[model samples]
Every structure is written in C-alpha cells, then in structure tokens.
Target chain A: MYPANKYYVKGFVMSSYSERLNEYISMVNNELDRLLPEQRIPQQVVIDAMRYSLLSGGKRIRAVLVLEFCRMCGGDVAAALPIACAVEMLHCYSLIHDDLPCMDDDDLRRGRPSCHIAFGEANALLAGDGLLTLAFETILSSRNLAPEQIVKAAGVLSKAAGYQGMVGGQTVDLQNEGKPISGETLEYIHALKTGALIRAAVQMGCITAKADEGLCSGADEYAEKIGLSFQIIDDILDIVGFAQEMGKPVGSDRNNDKTTFATLYGVDKARQIVKTLNDEAKALLKRFPKANEFIYEFTDSLTSRTC
Target chain B: MYPANKYYVKGFVMSSYSERLNEYISMVNNELDRLLPEQRIPQQVVIDAMRYSLLSGGKRIRAVLVLEFCRMCGGDVAAALPIACAVEMLHCYSLIHDDLPCMDDDDLRRGRPSCHIAFGEANALLAGDGLLTLAFETILSSRNLAPEQIVKAAGVLSKAAGYQGMVGGQTVDLQNEGKPISGETLEYIHALKTGALIRAAVQMGCITAKADEGLCSGADEYAEKIGLSFQIIDDILDIVGFAQEMGKPVGSDRNNDKTTFATLYGVDKARQIVKTLNDEAKALLKRFPKANEFIYEFTDSLTSRTC
Candidate 1:
C-alpha cells in the first residue's frame, strides 16, 4: 500500500535466510518426532492422529523463535529445546481445533487435509486435546530446566493458551463472525488469538536464559509489534497470495465476512503498518547487538512473499 | 453370577453419609466459585460458558478426594484447595469434550442441557479446551504449594488427562463403538478414560501432603481399586437407576451398542466385582488409620443408592 499503486509488495528474501530457516526447521522436526509418542498398537489410531498432525510439515516458526531468542541471549538451545517443541505442539493443537467444522470449517491445512478431515471429527478433537496436554507434559519433562523455571514456563504457556489467550480469542472470533466488528475489536482479537503465544515465546527465551528484566521487557514490546505486524501481513496474504503457497484456500476470511485488519485499514494501509512494525521490531533488535541479524532476517522473512 | 440368586444389589445409603457429602459439597462449591473466572465483559460469552459448565451442579467427588487425601495425610487443606479445584476442572473439561456431537453426541448432562447444547458447539469446544488449560494454570497458581510440588502435580495431572490416559481411552471407546471387545480391552478403556484422573486426584492429595513413598504407593493401589469399582457401579446404575436420579438418560450405552462391564460380565458379576473392589479399597484405607472413616464413607457412598 505504501509503494504507490502496488497492492502487494513482495520483499526479496535473502537466500541465507532460507538456508537458516530450513536448517532450524529440520532440527525442530527431528526433535518433535523424537519427543512425540510412537504410533503403536492399542492406542494406534489416537497416536497416529496426534503424530500425523504434529509432525505435519510447517515452518516451525514458533520453535525457531524460542530457540533463536535463547541463542541470541547466549544460552544453550538444548536447554530450551523442549520448551521450543512445546510451543510448536501448542500451536499445532490450536490449528487442529480452528480447522474443525464447528470452528472455521476448513478442510485443508499446510497443503494437506486437516486433522479432522483425515481422522474424523471425534478423533481430531481428541488429537487436539492430546497435543495440548502433551505440550505441558513435554515442558515438565525438560531435564535441563530447574523446577522453578519449568513452573514459570508452564504457567506462561497455559495462560497464553487458555481462555484468556488463544481460546479466549477464538471465542470472540467465532461470536463476531458474520458481523462487522470495530477496528479496535479486531486488534483485540488478533492480539489474543496470535499475540499472546508470540509474546510467551519471546518471554520463554528470556526465562531459559534467565535474562535481565530489561531484556525481557524489551522482548515484550518487540513481540507485540511483531505479532500484530505478522497477523496484518497474514491478512494481506489471504487477499493476494496463492492457494498453493498458503496451504488453505484464499479469501476464506472475506467469504466468512470477518472484519480483518486489511478490511478495516485497507490493503495499502495494512502493508504500511507491517513496514512500520518491521522497522520497530528491528529497532528493538538493535539494542541487543547479537540478536540484531538473526531476529531481523527471521522476522523479515515472514512478511515476504513465498510464491 | 453372585451370592445365591441376587442378580443385582443396591446398598442402603446412610443418612450420615449424605450429611457428610452435603457439607463437603458445599465447601467444595465455594472453592470452585472462588477459583473459576468471573463473568467479565470483552470475552463474557466464553467465560460464561466456562463458568456455566464448571459450576453446574454435580457431586464434587473429585475435588473432595484431593482434599480428603490431603487431610488424611494430616496436611493443611489450604495448601491443597487449589489442587482440589484443579482436578475438578480437569474432570469438567473431559465431560464437556465427551459430550461433544462427534464424540458422545450428548445433548444432556447433570440434568441440564449439555455444554454444547447450552453454549453452542464452537463455544463448548473452546470451553472444554479452556478448562483443560485452566487446570494447569490453576495448579501453577497454587500459592501455598512449593514450585516443585506444583511441577509434580502438573505433571501427574497432564499425564493422567492426556493421550495416554483419558483422551487415549476415549479414542479406543470411539473406535470400538458398536463392536465386540474383550474384557481386558474394556478394563483398559475404563482405567484410562476414568481411572487415570481418579488416580491423579489421589496422587495429588499425596503430593500435597508430601507423604512418604509407602503412603503414595498405598494411595495408588487404593485409587486403582476404587476407580474400577466406581466405574463398575456406574455401569450398573446406568442399567438399573432412573434417568432423573442419574441426571441424564440411561441405556445410551445400550442404544449406542457399546460394550460395558455389565454387557460383558453380566449385572450380578459386575455387582460382585464392585463389592470385591470396595473391599480392596477399604483394606488399603485401613492401613492409613487417620484416613479410615472419611475414605470408607466416601467410597462407599459412591456405590450405594442415592435416591
């Protein structure tokens, strides 16, 4: 929107960004596979549904954020690995539930049939519940973190994922579906729906590294800006992106009559917001000399076009 | 199938037992109300759904178990109250999910409209998920318990409530619906679907007390016996008890063509099993002299006639 008459501006992603993302994504996938229960006899169907949905291909963005932040803070990632995986598992659970017929009614996700489509609604529901429970259990099983840290992490994740966070946001989103909500309302929804977990990811990075309060507070502000920016970009992508690149079909939000950031602010203004957010996030990253490069590239990579 | 020609036997409930339960229920209800989220604006719909299902009238058996077990071990209940509430929250969440259309397809629970029926499917689903998250959140928020105890409680509750326990059992039940299953399989399903959480409640009680390993193991065995016994009695009640007394329609198990203890073992034998398990539970209870009277009355109360 800021680039004159261009409706969608595709930022050129650095080749090195792709390389880092792929390597980190691979690492996350391996750890996820190692941590998840094996699909075996007696509970095969349930475990299969769990593994299928959890191990399903994705960007591993949340896990990467946790790991990257910890690394930036000069902490060993092995200490934060389970926490990283926990966030991903929690995110996956939300995705499964959001795809349910009663929720968003989507059949496709990440270029494949959604969990409910593959496992049937009942099993899909259980799989979501299972994955969510496993996230907390996985966090508890983290060997490196002290019990106090584990308690803090679990408390943060649950609060972010619970009714006051993701689920709370989903409720508002559902209730407001087909109705025109105020721009403020839309922001509130997005903040809770997506922002809470994102903020928690950054906080966990601080928690694992036992970082200073200053860094933690800085991370909070950075997360909020980036989180809103990310959702806005997602809204923009839903309008202008390809179905193949996005996994699900395009324009479902428009079809559902959802009041989105793009709908309220216009595509151009939304993109402008995204640019502002990216700059602000980069500005915050600048404070941590070591975190600057990777954080900038990692965040910058999200808003850029995939196809 | 049992002693002489008694195909089924219903024990007479003591007035004294009812008095004790009523007092305990009142106390637990107050704690639950204290613990649950208030009906607040901005996300009132979701919070309302949560409060509705959680505060819906029911026997506070799970909560009482946690409280009583702590008391039996001579610990201050103030330290265990949040944990008591946590287990109840977990139980309530399971009930909500189990009643979903794709799962049990229930439209009624506890003599009232089921969560989905009352709150709509999407909200009900979120309510269930919210409650599950809250269970852990509630545990972490325990002010009196140490961080380590909180960690241990969260671990036990999540494992018991997760895929390997309740969710896993529900999966098996759904897969085997209307199909023949072995007695061993039925036992496995009940143990996970119901027994797991039951065990957790008792274990949390022991954890809160900081009990010795011997007492913990004893609690485990006692929980196992009473848990199975309780489910067997529930199966019996579903066949012989009135719908009004039970709060929901009966024979749905039969209508659904699902196999139960009664279906496989015969009513008299099921009753016989209940008696045996009750004896075993009591035998274990006797070892903890301080826990004897309350534990006996509570477990016995569950199996006896209520109306």
Candidate 2:
C-alpha cells in the first residue's frame, strides 16, 4: 500500500506520508462507491454523474483526518469510515457548486473538466445536491456507529457544511470575488469554507471514539492550526506549482482575481504563517502520545507538499 | 380552533379545513424562521435568501400531513414539528433548483419572483443547498424524537429525496420537457418527483407515531392516492382556476410545453382521475377513524377548492 515516493530528510527515510494517504484514499474511495447510488436505478445518469465528481482524484485529507483521529482516540477506524466518507462528499459538493456558471465558472477540476462541464450544469447542480444529502444518509445508515454518536456526527458535519458554515463562507467568497477584501474577511471565509470541515472531520472522529474532553480540545486546536495552514499553503502552491504537479492550472486565483494570502501578505509571509501554524499544530498534537505520530507526519507532509 | 367555513354534506357540518391548515402553517412557519440561520451571521445573504423563499408563502400542505398523521397515530404533534419542517425544507429546495436558469427557468414561484430571481442564481443555488443540508441538521438536532427514530427518519427522507427519489424524478422531468412523453413515463417522473416526498411525509408521521404495520401500509396507500390526486388537480386547476386563486400564473404547463395528466388525457378524464384518487384515498383512510377525519376533510378541500 506504500506510495512510490519516499520522504528523505537528512539521510534517514521518513515513513512516507504519501503511502499512508494513498492507502486511506483507496479505502475511502471504495466506501464512497458503496455509499453512493449505482447506475442500475432510474435516473442512472445522476448516480453516474455523482460518482464521477466524487471518485475523481483528490488528496482525501479529510478522510485521513477522521481515520487518524479515530485511531488516536482509540475508536475503530472501520466504524469511522462512513463519517470519513461523508466529509469528502461535503468537500466535493462545494467544489461542484463553486465551479458553476454563476459562481467561479471554472472549466477544470483536478486537470479534468469540472462536473458542470463534463455533465450539463443542471445535472451537476443536482449531483452536488445529491452528494450533500447522501452524506447524512450514509451516516444515518452506518452499521457500526451508535445512534447518539451518529446524530452528533451529523450535527458537526452539517453545522460545518450548512449556511452558517461552508455555504455561508462561499457566499462571502462570491460576493467579494472581484472586490477588495480584508485579511480578517478572508480568514472568516476560509475558516468556514475550508477550515470548518477540517475541524469537523477531526471532531467527528473524537465523537465517534467518545474521546475525553482534553483529547477533544487537543484535536480541535490541532485541526484549526492545520486548517489555516492548509489554506495558506494551497494559496502558495497555486502560484508556483506546475499544472502537472498540482493537477490543475496554476495562478487561478490571479486569473479569477481572488485575494489570497499570497495576494495580501506576499508569499514569504504566507510561507512563514504556514510554518508557524505547523509548529502550533504539532504542539497541540503532543497531548496524545500514541496517536500523534501519523498526525504530525501528515501535517509535516502537508506543508511541504508541492501540490 | 375551528375554521369559520363549514362543510355541509349529508346533514353534517364538518369543521373548516382552512382553519386547521392555517393553524399548522402558523406553527411551522414560526419554527422554520427559528430553524433557519439569522441575518446577523456572516453569510447573512444566504440566510436572507433562504428565508425569503421559505417564508414567502405556500399552503404548507406537506407540513400539515406530518402533524395530522402523527396525531392520528396517537403521537405528539409537537414532537413531530421538526420532521414536518424538514419535509417542507426539502420541498422548497427542489423548487429552488427546478426554477434555476438552466432548468425550468421560471421567474415566478408562489406568484412572486423565485429564489433565483430574488437572489442571483448562484446565491439561490447555495440557498437550496443550505436548506437541504439544514433539513438533515434539523432532524438530527430534534430534541423530541428518539435517536433511533431520528436515524430511521433520516433514512426515509434522504431515500425519498435523493437519486432514487425527487432528484431522480426531476432529472426525468427535465429530460422529457418539450418532448412527447408517455403516460407511464410521466407517471414515473411525478411518482419520484412529487409522490416520493408526499409519501415520505405520511410515512414520517407513521414512523413518528410508532404506528403498527397495517397502519403504516394504510398511510402509504393513502399518501400515494392523494399524491397522484394532488398533481391531477394541480394540472386541472392550471387550465381553469384563476391565477389569483392559485397564487401563481395559470397555463404554465402549456406555456412550458410539458406534458401532464391534463395534457395527455382530456381535461374531463383528468378530473375523473382526481375523483377516483380521492375516493381511493378516503377508502384507505377508513382504517384509522380518529385520524381519517382530518385527512378526509383535507383531501376534500384539496379537490373542491379553486385554489
């Protein structure tokens, strides 16, 4: 299950983060296929389109967080699969809608035509809607989780994904697209738009495991630090990364006139912010000695990744 | 509280269905206002648009079904309010998406500008997504319902709304527009699109009430009959009822060149179909004497009214 790339630092080989990520991605991708409707049903096109948008390559960072945090908290990773998959669905839903005609209107996703381009806009719209609904459906129908925890997980995911969360953040992002926006506003936008779900992914894992208060707080703080770092690094990568490396065109933010960390504070400051966030995240992870290894490694790999 | 309008038939003056419907509408609307995010939040625009469409005005027919059915099954209607509100949210989400620019492209809904018209299409789209997510979040958050029942209800609502349900139905409806459609195809479309949620509402009440198997089957039968009847009456009303009465313009079906029962069969035949469906619904309702009274009266109001 190891990815071919091995991280080498100062001559000692690091346990390859790519290998662990790929392993989790394969696991999550399978569950997602099982969770989504297959093509035999009526309106098979919708299911096909839904699968198309979801199965296309993404790093599966949220899924890994759910699993790794569950492992950290002594929860069954198998039982946490549904919650892990649900976060990915939420992520894909946002991408599908964000690329719509009236929205960012992007033609590419993962170097492929976006859902709206591959399927018609209307179907893409429904596909996004279907995925969001299915996220709950998957959790509600999950085989291993307790009912109370299922409800808790649903609340966490939805609160992060709903109007006051990702949807709300996207609204602000859309409204301020071409217009000048403050760093405070941008922080607010990404916190919900991207960070909210990241935070939820870790929280859902803690809930699934029934982790103690201290561990839960640690996970939350860890998630927030990495969440901010993730977005800042994403902003950095889009400017300098090649299309082949990033799996999509570079400088999309500039093309779309989006204000990111790079635009506001310069790349050096943004990189410095990412480094600071990484240190803070690792410090938070220190609370759980047994579970922090994968997480710390994961965070380190995230900041240093070219894509 | 009894409505002033009395239905005089066979020497009995049945309480006014309008008064009962109005009563439930008021309660549901208040809760809906409470359930949706307030304008003070950062994504105030998304919440504002969501409330504008949901609060504008509709019969709240689906919401009433949940309460009445719960009451009939001897369950607490107050406890059922969350599920009731959830169904309406799902219904509203579909309407918003169905009226989008690439879909039906309708400017009006309930005699006012649709969500896409009032808000821009992108915001309208997000509003629909936000409501759909909120529906699950509301159910998962319901304090009155048991966790097990919440899970069951989520499965029911999502299945009825997802690819095999309303979304699937709408897909067919969109594809078949402007083309000659068979009666079977049309039935398939409406069954998923309209009948699914209508059926889900009744089933939800049954589940909430913890009704026995026979009663659940009876509720299902009752819902199917009424659901079909509702559409037939709607098709019939468009050709004959006043726009003022219906709250939206009439002849929209003909204007859009979409096929319906009235279009495929003669108007007289469509009216007969409504009569037959109403009779069948009443027959199924006979299984529950206490609950059937309001449902029967409600069905009568539905068929005989100009609106």
Candidate 3:
C-alpha cells in the first residue's frame, strides 16, 4: 500500500534532502566545536569525550526540527540555530549519561566507544554534566532572541531536561528495567523521555519566531505526536534492521529486557500507529498554509526512512 | 605573640557565629524545601536522599557570600536570595557527587550518611544532576534580576561549572587519585574546583546590583583571595579539628593521598598563607569604603572559624 522506492529517486532529488540535512548538520558541528573551549587545564579529555559523541555522526534531527519549524512559522533559521544546537547538546548529554557503567552500561554509541569507555567513568560523568550546563549557556548567550524569549526558551529547555521530563523518564525506565512493561508505561516513558524535548524544540522555534499562542500550541501538539511516532519506528527498526544498516548491534534491547512499541504491538500494528500519528501531525499544519517547504519535506521524511 | 586565651575566645565567639549562621541556614533550608518537588513517585527514597544531605547542613557560606556581596554592593538581600539559594544548591550537588561510590566514595557527609549511602548510588547521582540543573533553573527564574543580569549570571555560573572550572578540577582530582601532592597542582584544583563558584557567587551579586566595574572587580578580587584562603583553612582544619567540630571525617585528604595546602605547606605555613590572603581580601574593601556591616563582619568571620 505504501509508495515503494519513493526515496530511491536518483541523483538530483535525493541530493536535495541529503544536501540540506548535511549542510545544517555541518553548521551545527562547527558551531558546537567553536563554542566549546579548546584548552583547559588538566582535563581536556573530558571536553574531548563530549565532542567525541557530539560530533560522531547523528542525523541532527532535533536541530533540523528546530530550524524547519522556525522557518515554517516565518522565523529566521539563523535565529533558531542556537536553540537547535542547544537541543542537540542536551540530547548528547542524555546519551552520554545513559551509557555510563552504572546506567545502561553500553560501551558502544554511534558505532564507537561511549564517553565512559573513552574518558573513564568519572570523566564521562563530568562530561555529561559539562554538556548539559553548556546547553543552557548556549541558549542564554543567544543574541538573536529577546531577553524574555531567552528566559522563556530556557524555561522550556530546563523543564524538558529536568524532573518532569527526560530525567524523570530515565528514572522510570531504570525502575522498570527487567520488569514486564505495559503499553501505557511504554507511552509514559517515551512521552517524557523523548517527546518532551521534541515538543520543546518546536515550541522554542515558535517562541523565537514570535508566533501566536495558537500557532505555538498547534506546533507543540504536532511535535508531541511525531516524537512518539519517531521512537516507535526506531524500536521497530532496531528489531528488523541489520547491524550494518542501523550502525549498531540489533536485538540488544531484547537482551536488555526493554519493552518497546514493536514488542508490544507487533511490526505491522506499530507501522499503522505511526501512520496515524503522521497524519495527525500533518493535520496541525493546516493552520500554517504558507508553511515553508522544509517543514513539509522534513515531516514527510520522518516515517519514509527504511532504517 | 598570639593571645594566650585566643583559641578559647575564638571558640566563644564562634558559638555566637554559629547561632547567626544557623538562622541563615534555617532560612535557606526552608527556601530549599519549598523549592524542591515533593515525592510523588514510588522513589520516595530519591527525594529522601536529596533532602538528607541538603538538610544535613553546612555553614551555608556560599549562600552567605552571595547575600552579603549583594548587600555590600547595595542590592536588597531578599532580592538576591534566590541566587544565594542557587549557589548552595550547586554546592550540595558537588558534594553529593564527590561522595559517590565511583568518586570520593565517602560514607559520611556533615555527620550523616552520604546521599549515596542513604539512598542507592543511582538515586544519589540523579539527586546531584537534579540539584545542579535546578540551580540554573533557579537563577533563570530569578524575578528580581533583569534579563541581562540573568543571562550574565547564567554565563558566569556555567563557566564556573564547566570543563574550565569545577568539572575540570574534578577530572584532574580523579586522575590524580592515590598520587603524590604538588603545590602547583593543589593550587590549580582549589582555584577551579572551589574558587570558581565562590568567585561567581560574588560576581553574581555584583551583576544583580548592577554595580560599577571597579566595584565589581574589587569584590571579585576579594572573593578570589578569600575563596582560596577558605580552602587552605579547610585543609588546615581537617588536620587540626575534631570530627564533631568539622562535621565530617578529618584526614580525608591525607587518607586519599590527596595533596592539600596543609600537607604541602605544613600547619604553620598554611596558617600564615591564610592570614596573608585574609589580609589581602580585607584590603580590597578599601575601594568600597561605604560597604555594609555584613561585609566587614563576614570577611572577619571567615578567618576565625574553627570549622
């Protein structure tokens, strides 16, 4: 029923998506590298550890979401770049801490040694702390946003990073480890852990663009749906995708006894669920009929990926 | 020659000092209790862990520094209370993490079991992360400071907390564990690990007050000298003071093979160094001739404390 090989279109069209995504990702990597201090006494290793994971290949999807959402809402992409960068920094920190020996104990991240493995456990812990603090510093230092906007954006970011959001989700996840996971429990974890920051990314863009409350709320709702959908799809791909395709070991989750949407609902059912979420997200865009091409293309590309 | 009964007199004066410090401590404790979220999760132990150390209580010297510096610079102490509270929050986080199993691995903090001991290791780690993030949130949410002030304060705080500062110092300390002491190395650790945040606390006060550059610079210099002096005295006290007087175990530095001012300079030399630093810090107050009673009293009190 799906459009087979839609993403297989040759050179020119595929290059457009690849080029745009790569360009933005490059900008983010450059900005992050530039912002972090190069020479600090006695512990350059900590910074290097942070940069290792931060610069190690990711799609930079969160940043792309920020940039596209801002542009769609008639905001300047340049103005949203700091928030975009900050989102990724926060995400990288979560990954670093989650991979620690006392946490998930994963030695590999993005197909290489995790922060703790590279820099030792203490440094890894500090690197996570450093990155998380730097994320706030990045947002606070944004000259593009108004002071009020900065404060509001900071509030959004902190709430997403803190107890009511990602950390709380991790706590719950850790508690539920090796336990029988219910569908509701899975939704709660994904909603807070992954969805909170995604929602914040869109909201930050809208706030920076000075969009109206209604527009911001609509974008937030859209982000929330797509965020969960993205994670569900990721879970499915982890099961079905090969190690080479996913760039990491498969069935790792099964070994970890982690419950995922694919485990709970089966592959076909999960795919249908993502379709429903994608449709709902697109429905929210009706308010912004003049939305930029980036938003439409990015949102469309979400579930279209094979891995 | 030193006064024959000076130690006794100092002890008597310290009792009064303790009472006053306790009053401020109670105020901060109340503010902190109100600020932290009540435990709703099954992890009441996590909240208990955070509260145990938070309420176990120290001198609250950092918060006092923030408050007194603001007061000395002509800002309302009440207005600066949130950031004052924040400094303590950040300090508490550092202490908790420092005592973690993989870190300092201490069982006692302020005469009670460390957070990790009271609440599992994972919970202690989370508590530290929560407190650190909460510190930034508190400063960002400060209603009294202007947006510029908030941003600037956040920058100062982040720099103090980042790789160039506390985290860097911590990484070095960890790497140097069970290693020999060096004067220069100890100096570097003290400056970043403790001195950075203390300097930031004073700077934060000046920023909030919108104090002039000369006044701010003067206060910063004073804070820097006193911060180092405080650490030196702490090292000295660790050697000389009783466990009950000091609140935590003494000889922790020696036991850990950590180089400290006392170990490097000996008791008499360390004492002399603190005196010199205290005098230098006091001399900076000449620039602020109209400084408040609290500033004079606070600086004077730092040198005379038994713990």
**Model 1 C-alpha lDDT per residue in residues B182-234, reported as the tens digit of each score:** 99999999999999999999999989989888888999999998889888888
Q: Which 10-residue window in model 2 chain A sums to the lowest lDDT?
A: A3-12
Q: Which candidate leads the pack in DockQ?
A: 2
User: Candidate 1 docking: what grade?
Assistant: medium
lDDT by residue for model 1 (A182-228), tens: 98889889899999999998889778878778788888899999889
lDDT of 3 by residue, A100-195 (tens): 877778888878888888878887888888888889889988877888888888878888887668877877777788888899989988898899
Tens digits of per-residue lDDT, candidate 2, A1-307, equal 2112421111103346566667677888877877774767568888888999999978899988998888788877778888999999989989999989899888888888999899899899888988888887888888888999998899899899988789988999998988778999999999989999999999999998899999999999999989988998888888877877776688988887889988898888899999999999898887875554556778898898633
> Where does candidate 1 clash, by residue pair?
A1-A268
Worst 10 residues of 1 chain A by lDDT: A1-10
Which docking band does candidate 3 fall into? medium
- The TM-score each candidate achieves on chain A is 0.92, 0.92, 0.91
Over 4 Å off, model 1? A1-19, B1-20
Who is ahead in DockQ, 1 or 2?
A: 2
Please list, in the order the candidates appear, how each scores on TM-score for chain B only. Answer: 0.92, 0.92, 0.89
Model 3 global lDDT (CA atoms, 0 to 1): 0.80
